[model samples]
Target: METTPFFIFLFIHLSCLVLGFGSVMVTDLYGLMWIRDRVRFTQVISVSGVTEKFIWAGWIGMVAAGIPLIILKGEIDNLMTIKLFFVALIAINGIILHFLHKKVGKYKKGEHVPNLFMFRLMLSLFVSQLSWWGALLIGFLHRHVTTIINWPDMPWLVSGLILGAFLMIWGLGEIYFKVKEV
Candidate 1:
């Protein structure tokens, strides 16, 4: 079969997904380290601000490209379904992270909230990273599963399922933490 435009678009979309997720992970890890007093908060904040901006740009690119790519392809199989689900999850997490970043700014500026609220926000960030990472993994693997899988081994499909389970756990833990905080 000829390589389709959809494949090109998918490649770009995946590239954005990787960049966005990787940026978030780096920022979150840096923030965590700073929180633990192992690094300078100022450094973490600076890096996070830069990375977050890049992530947002990448996300916008992905959405802009993905719409046409999905429509053009017009084939929603199991892998596509799995990819879309995780993409939605990543978008949701991005929204939550936007607000969480705002809260973190406010906190930095001496806006005090209940400790519970802070804890909830922290948990949200954690879950956001987890979901973002999981989604990227699913999206990447879904493209390769069937073609590479043996009749019994089913390597890629099995990994995708595992990733999906991890995504669910991440989302549930986020909700649980938020509720407990409140």
Candidate 2:
């Protein structure tokens, strides 16, 4: 067995996956602390700069490897395109979260992190989770599930699935944020 460029890219991409998921999980945990424990939230976030940096690194690596991996893998079909769409969603959500975190970082120690703001943050997190995990699953199953989607109706089906996931996950996130305690 010989290691090829494709294999190297795949490994880089998958390795980034683990790092990315870990960062996302830790970020969500900090968000939960923001909801449940203000004191701990500040302390944890203050020291979490390194983890946040690691996430950016992983995200960049994944995106960098993904383009070549796609080309190396050959012609993309509907499912692959949809998976790419989810990857775009993940990147978009990440940008949103970046700005939101900037706003959050400006928060003074004694001041409250507003519900509306936190709700927005939670919604962003939900989007991140949905897209990251969705894209990962779709990538893993893409070859196996390629036959399932009808090519002619692919756009509609992909759109519907993305919309449904967004709405369902965002709704659940909103509920959690709403009922969360200080």
lDDT of 1 at 69: 76
lDDT string for model 2 (1-182, tens) is 12499779989998998888788888777767766866465665664555677777888899899889877766676766777777777777778887887787788877988776777876787888888887787777854555244343576576577777777876876777677754
Distance (Å) between predicted and true CA of 63, model 1?
2.3
TM-score of every prediction relative to native: 0.66, 0.76
User: Of the candidates shown, which would achieve the greatest TM-score relative to the real structure?
Assistant: 2
Clashes of 2: 0
Candidate 2 — which residues are off by over 4 angstroms? 1-3, 33-39, 143-152, 160-182
After TM-score superposition, the amount by which residue 18's alpha carbon in candidate 2 deviates from its true location, in angstroms, is 1.7
- Model 1 TM-score is 0.66
lDDT on C-alpha atoms for all candidate structures: 0.66, 0.74
Clashing pairs in 2: none
